[model samples]
Target: MSGERSRTDRTTLLARNDLVFIDFDGTISVTDTGIAVIDALELDEAWEIEHQWRRGEIDSMECLTRQWGMVDLARGAVYRMIDSFELDEGFNELAEAAIQIGAGLVVVSDGLDFYVDRMLGRLGWETCPGEEVIKRPRRCIPRFANHGRVTDHGVEISFPHRSPDCDQCGNCKTAHLQRLRAHFSRVIYIGDGHSDLCAARFADLVFAKDALAEDFAQSGRPFVNFETLAEVNEVLLAPRTR
Candidate 1:
C-alpha cells in the first residue's frame, strides 16, 4: 500500500506544471555563500552592507561593489573558500525530486555567479538549455581597491567593476526571475535571509527562512516558513498543480 502511494505521489508531482526557483547562498547551502566570500578574503565589514541592503537603501550591486573593495585576498583563495562550502543536506534530493516532477529548477540569487556556479558545479547540477554566464567585474574581490569610507551603517569603498550596468553583486537574481516568469507554468521560490526578499514578491508560492522569513510573516507576504530544505523537500514530494 505504501509503495503504491509513493508511486502515485511521484506521478502526480511529475504530471503537474511547475517551476522551482531557488536562492543559492543560504537556501541551497548551509550558510550564506556571499558572506563566506567576504570571510575568506578577510574582509570584516560585510555585515554592515548586508544590513543596508536589507533596509533597501542601496541596491545589492552597489553594496557588493563597496564591500568587496575591502578584501585583501587572492583569486585562488577566494575560489577555495567558496568551494569549501557545503550544500544543504537534502538539497540534492530536493533537486532530483524537482527534476523528476518535470519542474524546471531556476536558481535566482542576489549572490555572484562566480561562487554560485562553483557551488552548483560541485553538486553536478549543470546548465539548462540556455544558460548564459553574466560577468560582473571586480569590486567583488580579487579586483582590489585603495580608498575606503566609514559610513553610518558600515565602512564603504569604491572599486572599478566589470559589469557596471549590473547592480554589482556576483549575480543578477531579479533579472533572472523576470525571465523565469515568462517561461514557467507555476513558479515556487524558496529562500532565507535578507537578499531573498526582493525576489519573493515575484514568485507564485514562496518558502522563506531567517530574516527573510521574518519579513514575510510581518509584512503579510504569502509564504511557507521552513527550518530546513528537508522540510521543503517533503512539500515538493507532495502533489502540486498549476
Candidate 2:
C-alpha cells in the first residue's frame, strides 16, 4: 500500500471519469500478505527491516534489497508458502460490489506480483502477467472467474517498480498508482504497513490501519479505521458521485 500524490497526479486522478484505487496484501486480503511471504521464508527478522523502513531509516527498496538476499528458497518454495495464506473474509464480495457500482478497481501493491497473481488465481481471478515478471508468454487460463467482481478478460496486472533500490516487492504499488494517475478519477488508498506510505498521500480518501493508520494520525492527516474487507465493502457500496 502507498500514496503521497503530487498535485498533478491527485488532480488528474480525482477528476478521473471512472476509477478506484486499491491496495492489495492486507487491504484486499484479510492479512498482510507480505508478512506471510516473509513468514513462509522464515525470515522472522524482516519485522526489524520493516520497522526501520517505517521509521524512515530506509526506503522499501533498500529494505527489500537487503532482506531479499537473506532468502535461500527458490521461487517455487516461496509460492508454496504464500499459498497457505488465509485470505481475509469478504474480499470477493467487496470486489463484486465495487464493480457493481460501475467503478473500475485497480490493486497496486509494493510486493511481488508472482505471489499476488497466485492469490488472485485461487480467488478465480485470471491475470496476464505483465512483462516485468515473465519475459515470455505463459499459458492463459480459464476465464478469470470469481464469485465476486470478475473482470471480462482479467484484472490489469502491472508491476516491477523502477528505482535506485528497485527491489522485488509483492507488487510495485507506487509505480502502479503513478500510471493510474494518468487516467483515473476518485482514487482511494487503503493499506496498513510501511510500504504504503508514499502512495497513501496520493489517495482521495485513505483507509488506514496498523503502521500506516498510526502514521496518518501522527502526521495530522485524517483516515478511517479498517479491520476487514467487509468494512471497506460497506464504503464502496455507499452511494457516491463519481
Weakest lDDT window of 10 consecutive positions for candidate 2: 141-150
Tens-place lDDT digits, model 2, residues 1-242: 23333333323222224445556667766677656656766787888997887676776556655565566555556556667887764666655544445445555556555566678778866555332111111232211111111133222233244543335343445556566655545567767876777777777678788878988988888676777866655554543422
lDDT values, one for every candidate: 0.59, 0.57
* Model 1 lDDT on a 0 to 1 scale: 0.59
Pairs with backbone N, CA or C atoms under 3 Å apart (clashes), candidate 1: 61-167, 61-168, 61-169, 112-170, 112-171, 137-162, 137-163
lDDT of 1 by residue, 115-192 (tens): 555666777655332232112111111111112343433334443222344553435445456665665566677888
Which regions in candidate 1 have their CA more than 4 angstroms from the true location?
Answer: 1-15, 40-42, 128-175, 239-242
Global lDDT for candidate 2? 0.57
lDDT score, residue 125, model 2? Answer: 64
